[model samples]
Target: MKSIYILTLLSFFVIVINLSSCDQSIDNLYTEKSRIQFKYFKEDTVTQGQATVYRRTYFDRTTLSFGMSDDEVQEDTAKIVVEFLGDVSNKDRTYRVRINPDSTTAKEGVHYKPFSSTQTFRAGRRKDTLSIVVLRKDLGTSFINPVDYRLTLDMEATEDFNLGMKDGLYTHLYMNNYLVKPKWWDGVGSLMFYHPKKWKILISFNEKWANKEKEPFNFNNGGREYFEALRNYLEREPTFDDETGARIYIDRLVEQNN
Candidate 1:
């Protein structure tokens, strides 16, 4: 009788151990399945006359925590591409994107693409946040613009996944501030009307500078000299026609150097 009791106890312990192992395996599978989550954020509403800015940022829990290679992370990232378009109704609206391929590179890849969605403008009020998602394989080789009205998404995968499209993700990302111009040619002949507010122009004047051939033309010292020369030429000969103006500027620089 005691032997039978001991055998029964051993069987119960074995069963518990097997169940625990199975549970652990299941938990690991779940962790691997939903390895990453991408989220986007933007303003909810904007006044008709004012410009609306949208910002997007992404963070991955599994990718951040695990020491995964970039290729691996990219494999998971290819599932979706989120775009932000500024004005919905305007036909001239453009999209822009700055991509940092790796953590080490300071120079970001910039791209501008036309928005492809049909514009649908509301009469009196405007919805603040416009969001869309595309499958990774469908994103193709096109550069994604963060600000654009029409979004083109191609989702080939039949699997359904919940994506978090919230305004909080963009809270910390950098947004390009742009002015909304009523017309494209508002008497100012294709101007730099919409540029980042925080951009600073750096000039370099070193004749022997070797870094110009490399990525991110380093504007450390003496760079302002280049800008100064260009500014002086422009101010002195503001009315010079395009061909003559370029020639004069070049001649002046040659004379100055000689």
Candidate 2:
């Protein structure tokens, strides 16, 4: 009995040792080399005029426009989020993003203000958002000949963040100042909902509506992100309907959407 008890204890000790070693291996994996990764947004908070695009080389992308807005909006901006991983330092760390010229065509200071040096990640912080300023003044007078300028940014490897993602490290910006209806607005929204003045104001609330994809909105439900804003705009602007000349009755849709 004494011999059997001793053998059992020895087996239990070996099992615990193996478990400890396995746990250590997992801990090592949990400790990643510190790095920052860029993402357009974490979730559906993108009601701010951006859409996700799926392609062969998957990367974060968003668009900026001074389109449809009044001349008062000569400038617009886009935001990119950065997330920190690994050890949190007691001191602030600095990082920068540089335009990847191979993928960029937008001229700095003309289309966008140049980025200043060294955006900081305060000590013990895990996330930050960077803004890119876009200018609409130089976008020329041809509403018919719409133009899109591209700006792609890359993360700079720094001492605090040597690790980087193999993919999804790029944020591509598609910017334009075309006041014309985007290629998508023909036939559908144009039949009843189409008036150049109305369309211009509508596009300001959500620019993606002008994008070339068919987006169905359910006023009865909560699909429209800028519903209140649109409703208010329509109420204030009394554009008469050509047929009956009644002010475009949005109250019917408002009743349903409400």
Candidate 3:
């Protein structure tokens, strides 16, 4: 009777261990499958004038199989979003794009073909992406460029059950630099240059912080004092030629520095 009891206890413990192991495996699989990333690249040469080109790429994949069958298949997709932030009124504001899939590529018993899209700008905030959806097999490209625009992308697995994992696997590509025309002196002086409407400038007089930092720092007191000083100076100053005005501006900066 004791032997029978011992055998029953051993069986129960083995069952519990196996169940725990399966649970852990499922958790790992979920973590591995849900992720999204974006990459940006610049394509421009110094000799090619001031034109700039930006590109973004996105990627995702998944596999599915029936528990009772040997048949299994995989699905993979890629999306690219490009954002253009600059003085939209001064630039050509158009884009050219191309997309092609490798027919010879296979992942986990699944094959894929590429599709692409390209177009010209119309009117908007310029936030859109080239989305390629591959099911059994479909391929194409598009060209998209519209005036005043930005770009962003959304990605997902084709399987319905994987829909919940969409957020974990989506990313947005970012461009850190803006294409601007060379700064030119206005006829009336006062440093005239067009910047993107979204850009902001913060002027400050904190020499200690400015000298120690490599990047532009925000005005410590909300820039109100800096603006006020400039307003007072202009109100008290006389009209002068462009060059003279510039000289006076430099002199004022030197005085502030001292």
lDDT of each: 0.29, 0.66, 0.33
Q: Best candidate, TM-score-wise?
A: 2
Taking the tens digit of each residue's C-alpha lDDT, what string does model 2 give over 1-258? 999999999999999999999999978863755777785444332233486644333447777766556779888877767776677778888777778989988999998888764677778777777788988888654543557889887888776675456554667887886554545445443234434445555566666555545544534643354545666777887655443345554343222221
**TM-score of every candidate:** 0.24, 0.60, 0.25
Which stretches in model 2 have alpha-carbon errors above 4 Å?
1-18, 30-33, 40-59, 87-90, 140-143, 179-198, 201-258
After aligning candidate 3 to the native by TM-score, how far in Å is the CA of 109 from where it should be? 37
For the record, the alpha-carbon RMSD of candidate 1 to the native fold, in angstroms, is 20.6
TM-score of 3: 0.25
- Residues 66-133 of candidate 1 have per-residue lDDT tens digits of 11122233222212223322223333222222222332111122212223233222322223222322
Clashes of each: 12, 0, 27
